[model samples]
Target chain A: MTLQRPVFPLLAFIAATLMAAPLQAREALASWNDGPTRQAIVDFVARVTTTGGPDYVKPEERIAVFDNDGTLWTEQPAYTQLLFALDRVKALAPQHPEWRRKQPFKAALAGDVKALAAGGAKPLMELIATTHAGGGPEDFQALAAEWLAHAENPKFRARYDRLVYQPMLELLDYLRANGFKTYIVSGGGVEFLRAFAERAYGVPPEQIIGSSIVTKFVLVDGKPALRREAKIAFIDDKEGKPVAINAHIGRRPIAAFGNSDGDLEMLQWTTAGAGPRFGLIVHHDDAAREAAYDRASPVGRLARALDEAPQHGWVVVSMKKDWKVVFPETPKP
Target chain B: MTLQRPVFPLLAFIAATLMAAPLQAREALASWNDGPTRQAIVDFVARVTTTGGPDYVKPEERIAVFDNDGTLWTEQPAYTQLLFALDRVKALAPQHPEWRRKQPFKAALAGDVKALAAGGAKPLMELIATTHAGGGPEDFQALAAEWLAHAENPKFRARYDRLVYQPMLELLDYLRANGFKTYIVSGGGVEFLRAFAERAYGVPPEQIIGSSIVTKFVLVDGKPALRREAKIAFIDDKEGKPVAINAHIGRRPIAAFGNSDGDLEMLQWTTAGAGPRFGLIVHHDDAAREAAYDRASPVGRLARALDEAPQHGWVVVSMKKDWKVVFPETPKP
Candidate 1:
């Protein structure tokens, strides 16, 4: 219960641990091209980790938060969660035959993204409520997992999970190697993220904080289950990001990363704290390799945050120039 | 994420690690008297940890939750957090002149526990809203820390942090040492517990899940800050515990410990999961060492849970018989 921080033996211990696997440790961030952006990340980690330095932070306080959608993986064309809902609408169409005439469900069934967008948040919420609820979380997780297994990104001709940027994966490894506890602070549903984040990003379910629907404990057939409700419990976006961060993490993070304005407040809240801080925005400007819509995009819009990045000292990572690889090497069959 | 469970070299590694500190690891639960309760705990841990055994569990799934108030410390006379709120009323009485006549405030100012209880939950809620809000979490955390530093339990004549049970602390350490992530699931306000739980119990802020007030991000002096609002956001007790667990942790816990009926649903939810699970209830029957009033006690009432523990296959530890020690030895000045 003492307020005393542990001694500086930590730095030596960390150095020795990394040195034990010298080649692997040094080659971290291999997908990141040698440039200012990557160097800035490396420098920040070194600065904060250097024992007895003014910017040094103890390992316990080395918290790093990253947004999930475009920051960790692809969010272009549509959010993967939205795609999952549309697929669910199609799969469950027989159970609810009225969907053939319903505006959202009819559009969703026909794969009409345009019509679904026209209905705005109400129809989207209805889709989410109908598809994502009325079952236990484990049931929903299984559904999501099953979908993710066979679901492919049309443009990449690869599984959606495989589209996770290799550079970002390297960055996650690099930060964790330097003693950072990485957390995914996403606008996506927690249940949706938890289904694949551990295997995809090495972030565990407990470490994944996100927007969620209200869930209630129920006794179904004398067995305990968490029944997902139609109502949204919280939306972890924009200003809600910082609020959720405080509510879930308690401590302010030392680093923040995102791809859109939805993460602006999280960056602001994280960087506004005293001492060493970091904020990075991933810019999707690689059209050939992946979809590059930003400011005008309905999903993962990058506007206000892009304009204010310079003032806030946030590093804007241009995907076209910064990453040597857009995705990991596909495993051979 | 792939559903692939990691192969079990884990048991060998765990055995070697434990052997590295053979004496220390073997005597982990030193404060517990050699009895059925201690044996049950050791056996459950071993059953789940043994490689290739039917009950073997992966390290990632080894989560354990403990109820805070009476489970880990003395909630005698009153819950520590309520006592803190009462003190806050006394401290801030000068600012709120109207509180002199306000029923709850008047009762709080006079330290009239009975009068405050007589007014029921409404008065208690008013006390919480008035004294626990209108400030940033950091500011409130500072207030709680300041109070905790000076506050002492009259019965023990020791600081509140010093009143944490030695047996529970050992249990926390044992779980963590065995790759289990321990979380404090409490009905007490998250902010209040976060201020001291980390230092007192080594459970970090993020790992402490509890009831919370609504918080929003606001700019004070053009800097981001989360202002606590005067509203109850969620109550994490009974059913709420499991609901909060699924929301915050996603995965169901493998082990649960509590001292009251408030934790019954959490125990049920954890035990009902499709795996080997363990639940324990602490029976405060050692009046000579501590206070004893379970079935009828207003604070930390343990009636229903005690009656149902047997059916749920939960071990009920009699404090007088099971524990060889209560609180940890006070540090020398």
Candidate 2:
């Protein structure tokens, strides 16, 4: 410069900086702390996507499945759906006077968590059937969308939409960016999760495979509609997870992520496939930022799956240690 | 002082010619004669794909459902699957000695087409079950693939893969090229169709929704496998088509193409969706290029749907008039 080196123009410097910005800004899984879990994901994806690599998967075969509840969003303090079910029970209780005196509905109306838990599986199943069926699929979708838009997370004091893990969201985008097709394979109701999955998780309704009640296509007053029936069509959890994945996706996922025992079989099925695969467990250990009760929690119990991860060579993503942030930023009001 | 033009390099000339070749040679639905049926497809696709147009549909919502049998390939000499099923029964007759005496199995084993046809729905269902179940999903897939790869259509003297309509194949590619996600909503066995669908139709396994037998996930020698059962999981036909479309795709298709009465509800459901929709019924009137039967045919009957097409604003693709050719060219040995 002292020897008359040309001085760069300000606009030129800004343009150059802007040109270089995308390279740095392209980093994905940003919420994840620099750790083995994140590194494993990047390495696996890199190997799988690299042309002519031994582990390279065809774009069509690069399927990734994620469990919904505790895995993607919060399920502790009662599964979000269970809370919705209880609320729906109370809402319908006004019409069904006898339900007010019923065990589950009685406990649900009283807002006694312990009593609802004690009311057992029968009552809970009944609540789900009543709330989920007897209406058109569109009607159920509307009900769910309305609830999710307004429903609050009791402990977090935020809406349920705000409770989804930021890291998981980033991971989803990262996988998709790397030619991976992401699917939500959850125990949650298909129509229930389908209502908000596209907006909440960037997954399409068709890609979300979950438990479903029997639904029939009918003509209601000259209008074609799919009316949900009370009978269970499929329960996509545990063993059912892999079955649903096979039935719907028809390809074994190369990568699978989950948070509880319910996902154990899905992870196993995914990893058991020939060639390089990735299995992840989102360990909810952040008691401060979020609820933490592994191996003992009533709602998202991390039992057999957590213990088996090491043997299966799966990365356990520690929510407490590995995440810079939990939920995504709450949108400005 | 000479006025001279520069000579073009041979390679450059060749590259330019190659670039121009597609424009001059390329044509979609070439097997389709220049008619309203072909024009309707082009117009509907253009309207739906044109941005800001009243009929414009977002690429993500541009779902197209197609029937597999007579619509896409030959089904005149009995559905391709039924022939495969009959062959399987004969192959497995040794395992079940009692089948030798049973009415349907005996007929299937003896290669009595007339007897099997007269045996009714019970025998038909039994044949589907036997061929579909009693093996792992992969086993069924391998069996189906092996058969399709080797089996030739006696009348056409061509393999089933070679029997797929050239026009339909072109149509599938055109739809996909226009950002429409093409799906096979078939009455054939799920695994049966899945075997050849990818290569034959350019449709992936996940996009092929068809009749499926119940499958249970089981561990055989520490290997996770899905074992098919005799029970029906779901039938992807008739009214069931709409239900299957909703359950699997979770969206109302904008365009539906079918060849039988079984596809009526699917077409109706597709067209009734409050927007620019297309419904096409392939009326097999070409007894020369292909077998012709509609009202009187037991297989791929086109009575109710064909009669109702005009009322629903659906286009009836007259195979005789519409198709310049029926099947694809036979590959060199």
Candidate 3:
């Protein structure tokens, strides 16, 4: 008996050709199953983009908001950004005695992963407040840039940037190519994501709307500076996503993508539009190639969205079944 | 003997191709008779843009600003926006009685073109104040949009937009195609230009820096509104151009283009850079085809800059000789 492995090179070549082909090529997403899931995306993009197409949205009105963590990139085990902050905290531990006594930071500093995980959302939020807040915008930017340059993913032993999903990169390019001004509306700190979003995602700083600390423009030591205040201006998560989208973007997004119950409001807001709209959920079902957990997962629980996917006419993409490859080219163990 | 007149189509096709070609295809100004003028421009841009180019400005440091009236678009005879405002004034004349006796309004209502031009800069500024300053942001935007839809150029009978110089439009596109983020640093009200600039020019509203009337974010009739206040925020012309550029854009432009002495300070600021920069002055020298005036032209005078063209490295383009065509074709006439 002879066994045949899928030809990786030929598959990649086909994928590249399909992506590079002009928009007229319907073959790009043709492999998607013929179900309500796929139809939602195809119909929304078509109606909104097509001129004189009933749901035709003008170029100025074509705003598409996206969640960064778990949606655009892999955010399992924990968010890649949070991992980077933890590494920074560990590296700076010798200078601060306060962190040594803190619950989450002490667990992180002592190399107690289980203990840190046990601390849950409250302790994680505290860690974020210590590292991401208090610093001025410039100082926060400098710190983020430094971490981005040096931080490596513990699992891959590669730079955190190398872990970005290639498929999502193609989707971002596709949306922008289709006259949609893509924005990263996320729960991540706005200043943190802004430092590298341009170079990594091709989305400029002004286009980013995320959780942010209040900042005041002031003349400090005879020079202008935007001082970071301790107060949180907004938290762009859960129901806050819809409120932030209305306040900042000033328009409802024609398309929205997410992977968790945290994104339910955003998906609802996007689909509620009078014109064409799309809502997609990425179901993490591949435990072999990448970490996969669903309703029971503590970090990125899909819960309500997962249960409601069938009734709501949303595209639920099963990662294990759909993606031919995951995380680009990682060496087989 | 037979006389040959060039067909309009053949001439137009050649001009369009020339305008669309990449800027590098154009000849360098090195061979031009104006030596110092050419050097000033080249040096400024080079220093600010080059990596180790003496003025080696970083990406964040690359801020180039421009004046709209006379500098960017044609502001001869009367400012195009003001003409729009005057037409709006006439449309709204039936509602107001005092306008019939007012000097500028009387000049506007009586169809007295000579008297309107004779009113000069002060009366023109006052006219703008009366029409533009009292209205809130939304009120002004609606007014500008309404006026632009109906206002016709008195000379051409085409819309005022049809009167824009083809060469200037090409120049704006050319500058943006380069690394420079071009900004409109004009004395005209910011909200006025911002209303149509994004569509007319590719510049976004956030990138526009101009003179502003003070506005307060207030709840009016239980709705949030930006109310106009009778106060000047920034005047962006003459000596004020450089100050506004420094204050808002925060970096000197490596390149500057203007058609009048009103842009002298802006040209100076751009040329002051230590490396390669470019300063171009459009000389309206085609009297038969278009209005040609230089030293004594009241609207777009090029006197002081014209005198110093020999000492400064500025490229004074002769519109008649340098450009094959002045304006784009307007409906057979």
Candidate 4:
């Protein structure tokens, strides 16, 4: 009679939990291979969450920042934002007659990839300026969203959204499940990233920090809007990443994920904090599953960050060795 | 047999819900007396949250920003940040013999409020710069935390944290419970507010936006730290509020709450955005329980915002009539 009540409650609890498990339970980061990289992530999270553990960090202080382009999705061939800009320029070329002869525009109009690459940063800036400026934020967001919906990756012939690495998607979910507030700190245009980041990443709009052009809050034809200006306000790359992160987040994140040299400073800032910290870089070394060019790649050069990784104790996650799959497979009709 | 199985599950669900009711259910905005202001707040929230209502706003876009000082807590006599600065100046007097004769420091050390008031913005800036700069972020956060815990409001003799208005606390909780992401957009020092706001208001550091001084990331004896500098990076007052909001949040808030002219631009910007918006100004009109001053008060002068509130259809909250209590009651010994 004394043991019956307790045993009955325990049996009921187990039965209830089992009934709920099918719809509610999930294996976090299931796409990640069972390896050292996965172990380090899981171990760090466990250490921080353990009550009274030496490395225990409070749930509220569990901040994690991520770099978008190369880290979250494929930035190979070119950044998705850059590709959108190129498409916009081509679509609007007829409106600007002088662009028929201009170097970057000329190459862009002809879809000449080599000529555009040879022109370098200056031409890239011109392309960004022409496509991005002279509009309200809403208009820019709409254009970017429209392009992203229809744009296809050349090699995979899949929508840009589908090109996201399955492993990274799992990482974001895992971090959130562990009481971490995840943020996207990217070098891409702030407006461009805001367009789809919420839908694609499950990271909210307010959690994204990125490069921006100046904007003036004004009434356009009696409607309130933020008009984008041509002036470059901030560039969130390399040293600028740390500066932007401090200016916006105002707190040093405990964990950071990145893929290029541009993320070097962000990683350093995060890892250099007093307590336990995690830093991971996705090394694109698998050509079979995804385009793999680093060290010499113009889009996202990985040389400097790769060279410094060993000294800094940063994890270099080899996509080939650490992942069983790259992008999510398409659903059959 | 099928009917019996379904009936058992339904009974279990009802029993579970009944067990949860007492713990989960509570009155929102209970501190406010039955009035038009409370009704408006409730109605706006309900309309926005209704799935197919004309005023419905998505969960991600349901952003509400609040001013810190007079809106969330008392800023009477002096801003809380200013009070801390005065205390710091007095405390550090022994270390600096020269400060004994310096205008702001001398006035601060002497506890001569009239002299400090006469010294104007210049002296205030000097006090802020002297108290804030040169230290790393962690050290400053600790110092601020220590002071807030012990500092008492002179009039009420209550700890600074306990001086927060009960109605505002209810409103913050109510908004969050209704899927709104609340942010503190204030003109106070960002670092100072970040130190105690989280504990006091249940607002996290990342959600606080404020005026800032420049800080640089550096290696202090080979350990990385963000060292504060004596440069005003941004001032989030009047014209600066919208600019700061744009730079930090990137999206126009659906609602804004403030007490003074410093919040004029923020309210205008928020209300001007297309769709159902809410703007509120807390009229500090309770002289018996709290200080009552507007239009001419040197600290948190309410002239412009008060005048503009009516034209913008902003709700002016009469604290004396609306609030059942001014601050949280002291715990019984």
Best by DockQ: 1
lDDT by residue (tens digit), candidate 4, B1-333: 000112246545544433322211137677788888888888778788777888899877889999998999998677788788889987877888998888778888887765664443456666777878889777888999899888887777877888888889889988887778899998888888889888788898888898777777776675666778877766677666776776677688999999988788789889998899999999999999998998877777788889888888899999999999989775211
Over A1-333, each residue of candidate 1 has an lDDT whose tens digit, in order, gives: 111222334443443343322123337878888889988987888788777888999988999999999999988667788789999988888899998997778889889876665453456666887789989999999999999999887667878888788888888987887779999998888999999999999999989998888899989887888899988777888899999988888999999999988899999999999999999999999998887877887777789999989998999998899888888886312
Q: Candidate 1, residues B56-114: lDDT per residue as tens digits?
A: 99888999999998899998777787788899888889999998887778888889886
Clash number for each model: 1, 0, 22, 0
After TM-score superposition, the amount by which residue A304's alpha carbon in candidate 1 deviates from its true location, in angstroms, is 0.6
Segments in model 4 whose C-alpha atoms lie over 4 Å from true places: A1-26, A50-54, A90-130, A220-223, A331-333, B1-26, B50-54, B89-127, B152-158, B331-333
Measured on C-alpha atoms, candidate 3 has an lDDT of 0.65
Model 3 per-residue lDDT tens digits across residues B1-333: 011222344444444434323343123331233344444444554455445545566655455666677655667566776676577568778987999998888888876655665544555556666667665565786778666666776666766555666655655664453456777777677777777666666776656766665555444553333456656544566766765554334345777777778788778767765656667787888787667888876676779987766667778887666665566554112
Regions of model 3 farther than 4 Å from truth: A1-62, A102-129, A132-159, A177-179, A194-206, A214-233, A239-251, A294-297, A304-312, A330-333, B1-174, B177-179, B182-202, B205-333
Query: What is residue B278's positional error in candidate 4, in angstroms?
Result: 1.7
- In angstroms, the error of model 3 at B165 is 14
What alpha-carbon RMSD in Å does predicted model 1 have with respect to the real structure? 5.1
Sort candidate 2 into its docking category: incorrect
lDDT score at residue B331, model 2, on the 0-100 scale: 43
The full ranking of all candidates by DockQ, starting with the best, is 1, 4, 2, 3
Return the TM-score for each candidate structure. Answer: 0.92, 0.91, 0.54, 0.85
**Model 4: residue B316 alpha-carbon error in angstroms:** 0.8
DockQ for every prediction shown: 0.33, 0.19, 0.06, 0.25
Cα-based lDDT for every prediction: 0.84, 0.81, 0.65, 0.79
Give the better candidate number (1 or 3) by TM-score: 1
Residue A328 in candidate 3, Cα distance off native in Å: 1.1
